[model samples]
Target: MSVTKTSPTTNTDASLLADHEVESTYRSVNNVQLHIVTAGDPDAPLVILLHGHPDFWYGWRDQISPLVEAGFRVVVPDQRGCNLSEAPDGVDAYRLSELSADVCELIHSEGQESAHVIGHDFGGFVAWNVALRQPSIVDRLGILNVPHPTVYRDTLKSSPQQIARSWYVWFYQVPKLPEWMLRRNGMDNMVASLEVTSNSGTFDEETIERYRAAWQHTGVHPRINWYRGFRRSGSPSRNTVTQPTLICWGTEDIALLPSMAEKSVDYCENGQLRMFPNASHWVHHEREEVTEELLRHLSQNSLS
Candidate 1:
């Protein structure tokens, strides 16, 4: 599904996770190599985290230790076109359906019939769509930011608030300029916007540099093509989520207004929302502690 989110003030190939060390491995899905990071025992209930654009598996660095310590094996993949993952040419290569299929294949590789999922930004987009496509594999869902595409489209048409907040989606629709600007300007704007969008400046000097590295990776055109593909694909097929869902939103997010956030719960059959008044688009990072609590809640709820 396509999302009308703000475009990165920049996108590049800069590393974002500096303080923590990440172990990497590969899993083949859809005839492409998927770079994934696994932490904890292979026998534990798998928790898969997905990162959005200009970010990588390291996006979950802060949550990895806590999640593993909680007795859940955590997995974070660099999706098909981002980071070390295979960057196959073509917009269709990164479609919502294809993204879901990749996760499905990854789960099967770990010898599991189903897995719990948590995604941020574009990764959340993939998570939501995957739940719809393969409810059998989605045990529970935790989403940070990244609204329902249906609500997003309706908001774009009706709510001037969401429209004003999402001016960057249109900017990204431009060809060549975004790539050139990101390479020339670096990720200062993207990082700054991320900081500004969130209540806290998690996108500090250090964090911004890391995001720049991922955005600037080779074949970034196909990576950026994710946004272009969505715009061209338009609204995707909406499927009711059979899995329980926990959605966390930051009221301070500049891209998605709180009203749109409040009104979007009907899409899930079993859904809950946790609001972070001071958080922004990257609520997961801004309120990592609180988001983890919600994850624990999801774990327990699913077990019951």
Candidate 2:
């Protein structure tokens, strides 16, 4: 494992977890080196934040301070194949089982038996798998703007609306074209997609630039590999979630339907769903209300 300090590039970069004191390091976990940003006391209850597609640890910037101040150690990682994290070649390397193992190993790396796990978008999918595959390592599960794996699969097959919205996933199946298109014109198309899919003012110029920097460092192929890998990963063997779960969703998500949220709860033994009518797929970016809700969920039913 290699550890080093992160040099700040902009004012926003400098302010990341500024009040709580931030530590950036690279740890070899699950056969890949992951770049992780951590804050709050090392002894506090752990809470891991997983970011989604085309996003890095910075995606959880808005909620990090709040979680830290509330007496929780927050660990946000640039999952393998994104940002400064090591990206292993091949779509199979990015499979759901492999991604889930990274999280499980990450918890052990922190010297923790279990931790509250929360994720958004693709991260949410990873979180769900982690809870399902290794329930004992997850104290609580929180998913933002993503449905259960089975729900997502069933929706994609049964609902034309979902299939239509997910046209990009099919487009990504092509070998090199999707990567070329995403990288064209200084990543203008990729930047535009973020702005268009999210609610107005969700991603400002500075934020977009921050993402652009990470995208340039990681390249587009590994990120696109997530979609490609999922296509070949096959259906999940275990769908039931025994751990306490919270699903926070933005109803206006262009890619996933709101009905999936209600359906997702069905698979959980004890699960609750909160819908943000006006928020888009980037519900975690909404910050205030979602953060409060997350804190409440994590605080309840202490597993420690």
Candidate 3:
């Protein structure tokens, strides 16, 4: 399908994205139409940014303009079941393999065989699995605040502390309740989850409201299905990731432990880990250091 042209900005988000030349489009990938935001020169090298749960393409507002100025065309997509993207029925539709395939087909639809892939949180899970399942199509890999599946699965089963920190995961497993609970009071619960989980004041009033609005589009069920699918699917078979990968983690994350960052690297044949002690799960927003590191990593990879 040819890319559909639309404006990426909303009244609330426009002020934040005012300076960037952002374009919104819908691309048919993996039998679903995903809302994608693109910036920079079409002829430039492609860098795909994937956002995690409870976010849409706007989640990369901080990084999008910077990456574009760095000379790479950026593609930020609202993955399956999030924001303007099509939400297919059933948990099976949201599995890791299917999620990665959506990315695979997205790149193909963009007239590129490969791209520099970066993902945060759940998007990191998709990014990791994409590189594992289709290494040839991924030129470089970057993951933030998400562990390698092998390490995370083990931690969830064996580490009581991790299980405790991830109590929401278990809570989200019950059908429909999490969705209902999060949507209450204009998504006050969802907004609070982002605010309290991050470093104090990382999410300003405008940011929180914008996120809440984004979540309202696809609603709670599709957003939570990623967890439900993951829980049902179990650990993936592929254990080793040979891609030159960069994992950036914030130490103060309330959900994922810092040790999981180190263990995530062990799964990669060529990987590096950078930790931000003062930052929370929302590292990219908490500090500019991770953005600088990401640019450096991408530049190095491009030269290699």
The Cα local distance difference test for each model comes to: 0.73, 0.87, 0.84
Model 1 per-residue lDDT tens digits across residues 231-256: 76534455467688888887777777
Kindly report the root-mean-square deviation of model 1 from the true structure over all alpha carbons: 5.1
lDDT value for model 1: 0.73
lDDT of 3 by residue, 1-304 (tens): 1222233344323344777588787898888888888889988889999999776777788998889989899998888887677888788888888899999998888899999999998999999889988888998899999999888889999999999999988998998889889978988888888878887888888777677666756677877889888877645557888878999999999989999999999999999999999889888888898899889889886676
Candidate 2 local Cα displacement, residue 80, angstroms: 0.6
Superposed model 1: Cα runs more than 4 Å off: 1-22, 234-238, 301-303
Using alpha carbons, what is the TM-score of model 3?
0.93
Q: Residue 216 in candidate 3 has what lDDT? A: 58
Residue 1's lDDT in candidate 3: 19
Clashes of each: 15, 0, 0
Worst 10 residues of 3 by lDDT: 1-10
- What tens digits encode model 2's per-residue C-alpha lDDT throughout 156-262? 98999999999999999999999999989989988988987899999999789888877776688888989998888855568899998999999989989999999
Q: Mind sharing the TM-score for model 1?
A: 0.87
Best by TM-score: 2
